[model samples]
Target: MAETDVISIDAAQQLATAALIANRTAPDIAARVASALVASEAAGQPGHGLSRVPSYSAQAQSGKVDGFARPSLERVTGSLVRVDGAFGFAYPALDLALDALPEMARGNGIAMAAVRRSHHFGQGGLHCERLADQGLVALVFGNAPKSIAPWGAKEPLFGTNPIAFAAPVPGSASLVIDLAVSRVAKGKIMAAEKAGRPIPEGWALDRDGNPTTDAAAAMEGTMLPIGDAKGAALAMMVEVMAAALVGSSFGFEASGLFSGEGDPPNLGQTIIAIDPGLSSGGTYGERIAALMTAMAGAEGARLPGSRRIGARLKAEREGMEVPRLILDEVRKLAGGQSLSRLD
Candidate 1:
């Protein structure tokens, strides 16, 4: 393991608070946003951890991301809703969708929501897990700036385009699955680049269209999808649902969330919530729980959400481990000092 420096969650929150305050964001917004990031790290997703704080702070300060923006909702039908993120981070808008989904699902047996003009949301699975915890099954899809190449093509044409699903399970954490359609996430590439490490073979192609492990070159090139054509096809489906269906920017047309572009990324996300009871005649939870029990009873099969939930519990009890470089950067940013590390 790398030499990990552990810090209490409170310390992480304090650092996030200081950084956001230094950037002039409202205290409440700062705390909420910081808590999200901290929660991601505590849940073992370092790709969406403190590494993103500086970028978020910069985006807020530069007006690319509106710290005070609130989502506006429009009911398209009894079972469908549309949300405008108002050029803000995706969490708040997604929260709105979650709030509306239960009532809509109860009324209609299913609910669907589409959101546009949002920023990067760390993990779609988190949202689905929340719904699953509330006795609903959920599927979510999100699209971002183009970073992946289509099958047999060299240039980038689609974003990583993540999809997530969650279902309720008794006596265990919800069964949640979240993965990038690409072989790896762009954030993973960025992390490898920052650590001066080579990515694995098959994850990306070089600018010249040859496979490469060099993170910097891979960033300049394109990512291949998992399972070759199958994953690419899934990514295309996500693009259609999250971008085309929502009338939002698609692929390369979307603004880069991390590049500090003045324009909003014009991100799009789609969520589907289903009240299982409506389908299973009120025994939905018990049936789903029984299914999970049977699956877990199989040899060597662990629950879907076990790893992440375990990571979160461990972090809560033992604190989270952050990289030294990230810690130093956060300290510098929080202290109102510029650092050469990011440069």
Candidate 2:
């Protein structure tokens, strides 16, 4: 195994921020990206955490992502909001949507925001969790570069789309559910490839439709969906909600997110926030608590997000141990040394 280095949460954030700034990202934008990446790291999602900095910095420096672009918000209706990322990182666009959603949902009982021209938004659950923290329910849908094939086909057509839901529970952390349609996220395969490890069988197929343990081949091929045909159908649903409905590029139309040679991904994300108090007549808290109690009461049963919550708490209390190679790469980027490509 590769050597590892320990880093506190604050230090990790600072390092990531410096790396982005060195690669031409504005200070404010770099900070937002760093915060999201570090939070993902703390939550035990390494694929969406520090591992993304190299590619992100490369894209910013290459103009594939507009490092200095500012996102704009448009209130399409009383409860409908639209945000244009302007081909920038997705964090600022998502921030604007989250900031506007609470007031609109409370007033209208429910509200939705559609985001377009954005890049990857790490850990959709985090976005929904924010709304849940404010006593509102939230759902987030996002599309990525093509990676999964439609059922019964070798050619890839859909991304490993993700869906996340979060609901408030009185006197406790919110219930959060987040999952990628694929059997595993593409980032995991990328990580394995970077580590020179082979993936387990059934996770993906080679370009010729043969199952393979090679991580590099899997990246050039198709990711198996979570529930076979059922998962593919879910990915299609997300593609419509996040891309078609939002007027953004389809998964097949987007370029690789790991490389800096192509045009912007122009991805899309849709977030919906609902005011539980208005919908449930103020009984939401009690009802949710009862449901939580029943679920927790079951033998050998664990609540959703339990593992992630534990990981976050442990990271906060004891810092994180990051791979030494990844830390070195980040440090080099922070010093203004541009990499031609991360893939």
Candidate 3:
């Protein structure tokens, strides 16, 4: 087995900074992007963390992801809006959508925004949590390039298609549920491949349609859904709402994020925010607080989002620990000094 090395969060941040600089991303955008990646690591979602830096930088340098593209918004109604990401980083586009959500939800009791032509937005739960922080309930969904296969099929048909929900709990932490509908995300396959390790069986199939533990072969095949057909059905729903609903690419029609050529991936995301107080007659906050108290009061009962919140708090207080191999790759991609020198 290969050895694992851990490094502090500051080193991870510096590596991401170097990658962004090498990719020609602006300092402000680079910092925000780096923060998101590090936060993913802090939250224990390494698949979405700094491991993605090299690929992201390569995309930016190859012009597959424009570093300077700014998103433009089109407000359709008091509660409905659309944003064109203009091929920029999805983080900025999601930030713009969150910024507009409060006023829209306050005005109409609910707000929905469709994002088109965006890149990967990291953890969907983070987007929902941002709205929950403002005392609103949020649902977020996104569609990516094809990786998972439809039921009874051997070829890839849909992206992992993640969905997230968050609701404010008044005096306590927000309740958040975020998950990819597939058995696992494609990034995990990539991670396993990077580590030259075999993935668990049932995670994916080989090119010949046989279930395999080989990460590289699985990448050539298709990913399985979480609950057989159910997850695939949910993925289709998300694809319609996030991609078709937003007038963006869907399924195999979507550009490959790893191709590094052709048109941008043009991924799509949907965000919905609701002001519960408007419908609950001022009792929504109290109700949520009561439920949270009851759940926490129960023996061995932990609330949703608590784990990530606790992890984030610990990371904030004592700093995050990241895998040194990921850092080394980032440095090499950024043209910085090699890890051998530090060793």
Give me the overall lDDT of model 2: 0.92
lDDT score for residue 170 of model 3 = 76
* Predicted candidate 3 versus true structure: per-residue lDDT over 41-63, tens digit per residue: 78877778887887788788888
* Per-model TM against the reference: 0.92, 0.96, 0.92
Q: Count clashing residue pairs in model 2.
A: 0
lDDT of 2 by residue, 150-266 (tens): 898778999999999999988889899999999988888876776667899999999888999999999888999999999999999999999999999999999888888899999
Decoy 2 TM-score against native: 0.96
lDDT of 1: 0.82
Local distance difference test values of all predictions, in order: 0.82, 0.92, 0.83
Write down the worst ten-residue block by lDDT for model 2.
334-343
Which portions of model 2 show Cα errors greater than 4 Å? 336-343
- The digit string of per-residue lDDT tens for model 1 on 188-304 reads 776566556788999888889888999889888888899988988988999999998887888788877665656878889999999898978899778876787698689988766
**lDDT over C-alpha atoms for residue 35 of model 2:** 95
Question: Cα lDDT for residue 249, model 1?
Answer: 82
- Pairs that collide in candidate 3 are none
